[model samples]
Target: MPSGESGHALKVESWGDPSILVTEFPDIEDFHGQLIETVLRLEQDPEFTRHFDGHVGESKVYHVERWDCPAARLIDARAKALFTSALKKENAVVDLSWASVYRAGNYCLPHSHFRSAASLVYFLDLGDEEAGGRFLFTDPRLKICCRHEPGRMTYPVGPQVRPGILMMFPAQCVHMVTPYHGTRPRITMSWNIDDKALPGNPLPN
Candidate 1:
């Protein structure tokens, strides 16, 4: 954790041994490739146009966001269980959506989720032995990019990216994927949770 984030920010804690916990479950289940392929095909289909570059530096080409996907729903169910078990919030819901990212010449900007409790990313097809597509945090530490640590310990968030995995963290964490020079496109799924389902223009208590 960074300085100045104390008190006002949440802190990470030990699992089972402590009250609040942070856990990491690896290989929870292998994602079906066909399900991933089907979603990818839909995103690539001309009818489902890709979003235009936002005029930012090296803007990545992304498939128009997808929310009504069966595949996405499947992942949501699993993620909900994971989140609930980890956070001890049994009633928590894993709200999320799908989006195919086409990484060419290395793209993606640093940003955080606007209205989410937590955000996640699932690597579907990031083909490369030496490709960089890490889920980075704003702080140099607490980095999800460094390496596969045994426990759910915090590290620096720098230029590190991996594939064939699902990563979850606070929604406020600033993150971005590094460029990929792989032959195949980098496809992934991302989403966040909205526990309250609050009404629009929520009134104060």
Candidate 2:
């Protein structure tokens, strides 16, 4: 996409209510090397555990925040360009973080990002079948105990968030990972974005 047409635009659709679509914009800015290297370094870092207080011992959710890190800057630059080219309406800023899961039963609780205007998850390493890890996105089913209306909640979910794939969505959407039975570990990087942090790049406005 041309830089001129790469300005920000409305990237969401709806099914009665607005729905965020998974978009694919070419990695024209060349952040692939940086993204891959960052994931590798972070995975190998001994201090990787330090940033994951939320999922340290018993918890399924563990995360690390690497603010303004060199790799994060590159990720942000690529994300900004894509946001401009694809989501012309939204000025999206990138906030960097990573998530780690170590066991078969590890899974993330369904929740939304409170501080971000939008959120993204980049698949890094996916554990084996025993790990049983799968990224799930569902419609409103506020109570797990109660039955949701037919077709309201999508179960088991669609699309396995595979490596090299970057998934972006509205920040408030509730999503989670299904427990993996695989013995290996599952890791993913995430970023948050908001209007203010996002630079102004209009889509022919």
Candidate 3:
């Protein structure tokens, strides 16, 4: 388990063959309001359009590291710490950091971030509990989906979605989000991190 800045141990739960670490960020009520507002504002920025690619209607992924906000900075710092703890290395660097806001009908298709060593996601908002935007991981063994038994197709994996929960998993793990049906937007921040810096991709100063 990783200790917070105040020296309190943060609870971490791990599961699955390759293992996924789920940690509840301490005292999220302190800054979630500000963080959510910042994310919503960034989602509307026209500049993010240039960075858009892949699924045409998926939520826009904005590089929030360039923004000079305390909420974003706090998330970046905590994400890097969690990434380092998950990799068991002291020098983890975030190669890519972005935030996404999922409104009604927004969903991510199955994809993998094969370029990075690991990936991190911080749930800023989960909308309604009944909303159907659960994050799921496809069984790595493609043949497993051919089985007719229950729970053999895809794994919901990780803890239930809620604000302040941070999950770190292998970058190559295939994952996707279910279509969201809530009136309120689902917000999340993500980072692609590795033990060492990449060649062309420079770490944010």
Error of 2 at 201 (Å): 26
Query: What is the per-residue lDDT of model 1 for residues 31-129, given as tens digits with 9 covering 90 to 100?
Result: 345555566566546554344352121222232234355554555565555455556664654343545465555556776665667666666666565
Instruction: For candidate 2, give the lDDT of residue 48.
Output: 52
Candidate 2 residue-wise lDDT, 1-205, digit = tens: 2122346442332222234444343442455456445555555555553333333212222233353255555445545554454557456555534445445555666767656666776665565744556776654633321244654564535354455555666777777766566665566666665656544431111
Give the better candidate number (1 or 2) by lDDT. 2
Question: What's the C-alpha lDDT at position 139 in model 3?
Answer: 54
Predicted structure with the largest lDDT when compared to the true one:
3
Alpha-carbon local distance difference test for all models: 0.49, 0.51, 0.72
Question: Judged by lDDT against the true structure, how good is candidate 1?
Answer: 0.49
Best by TM-score: 3
Sort by TM-score, best first: what order? 3, 1, 2
Better of 2 and 3 by TM-score: 3
What's each prediction's clash count?
A: 11, 20, 0
What's the TM-score of every candidate structure? 0.61, 0.60, 0.83
Better of 2 and 3 by lDDT: 3
